[model samples]
Target: MLRTQIIKLTRAPIRSFSAAAVRTAEGDTGGVRSGGVASSDSFNKREAASENKFIREREMETLRQLKEKLRAQRKHLDELDAHISDLESTKGGEQN
Candidate 1:
C-alpha cells in the first residue's frame, strides 16, 4: 500500500528524468553516466520505502490504541446509562 502511494507520488519525477535522458545525446553514451543514474535512483527508492514503512507502522499503532480507548469509553457509557435507569425506576416506585 505504502509502496503504491510512494510510486504514485514519484511517478512524475521519474517520468521527467526519463524524458530528459531520451532528449540528451550524452545521457547513455558512457558506462559511468548510465550507472550513476541507476545507483542514485535505487538509493533514493530504498530510503523512501523505509521511511514509508516506518510511517505506516506508527499510524497502525496509533489506530490500535485509539480503538482500545473507544471501546473502554463505550463500556463506561453503557454502565452509566444502566445506573441512571435503575435510579429512575427506584424513584418512581417511591412516588407510587
Candidate 2:
C-alpha cells in the first residue's frame, strides 16, 4: 500500500522504474514498510531543481548580452544619421 502510494506520487518515467525496482516486506498493518526509496526520490528532485536553475541563469545571461549589442548598434546608427545630416547641409550651402 505504501509502495502503491509512492508510485502514484512519482512522475510516469520514474514511477515505472521505481515500481519495478522497489522491494516490499509485510508490515503489521499490511500497508507500511521501511526503506530509502523516498530518500532517492528527494535526491532526484534536488538535482532536477539545480539543473533548472542553471538553465535559467544561462538564458538570462544570453538575453542581457544580446540587449547590450542591440543598444550599441542603435548608437552607431544614430551617429551615422547625424553625419549624413551635416553633409547634406554643407552640400546645400555650396549649391547656393
Candidate 3:
C-alpha cells in the first residue's frame, strides 16, 4: 500500500502523550485539596525535566548520525581525489 512505502521512507520516530492522562493527573492532585499547588508545581517540574532529557537525547542522536555521515562523505571525497590524481599522472606520462 502507499502508506507502507511512506513508512519505509521515513526514518524519524514519533512520540506522543495523551492529554486525558495529564488532565487525570491534575484532577487527582486537585482532589487532594491540601497542598494542591505544591503538588501541581512538583508534578510540572518533573514533567519539564523529563521532556528536557528526551530533547537532549534526541539532539545527541541526531548529532551522532550527522558526524557519521560527515566521516563517510569525507572518505568518499578522498577516494575521488586520489582517483583524479592517478588519472592526471597517467595523462602526464602519456604526454611525455
Worst 10-residue lDDT window for candidate 2 reads 27-36
Per-model TM-score, in order, reads 0.62, 0.58, 0.63
Off by over 4 Å in 1: 1-35
Residue 25 displacement in candidate 2 (angstroms): 26
Task: Provide the lDDT at 59 for model 2.
Answer: 100
The order of the candidates by TM-score, greatest first, is 3, 1, 2
lDDT of 3: 0.86
Q: If the candidates were sorted by their lDDT against the true structure, best first, what order would they fall in?
A: 3, 1, 2
Pairs of colliding residues, candidate 1: none
Cα error, candidate 2, residue 57 (Å)? 0.6
Who wins the TM-score comparison?
A: 3
Q: Candidate 1 vs candidate 2: which has greater TM-score? A: 1
Give lDDT per model, in order. Answer: 0.84, 0.82, 0.86
Q: Candidate 2 lDDT, tens digit per residue, 1-96?
A: 999899888846533635466566663223323566686567668988999999999999999999999999999999999999999999999999
Clashing pairs in 3: none
How many clashes does each candidate structure show, in the order listed? Answer: 0, 0, 0
The sequence of per-residue lDDT tens digits that candidate 1 reaches over residues 20-83 is 5435466444335355778867866898899999999999999999999999999999999999
Question: Could you tell which candidate, 2 or 3, scores higher by lDDT?
Answer: 3
Q: List candidate 3 segments past 4 Å from native.
A: 1-34
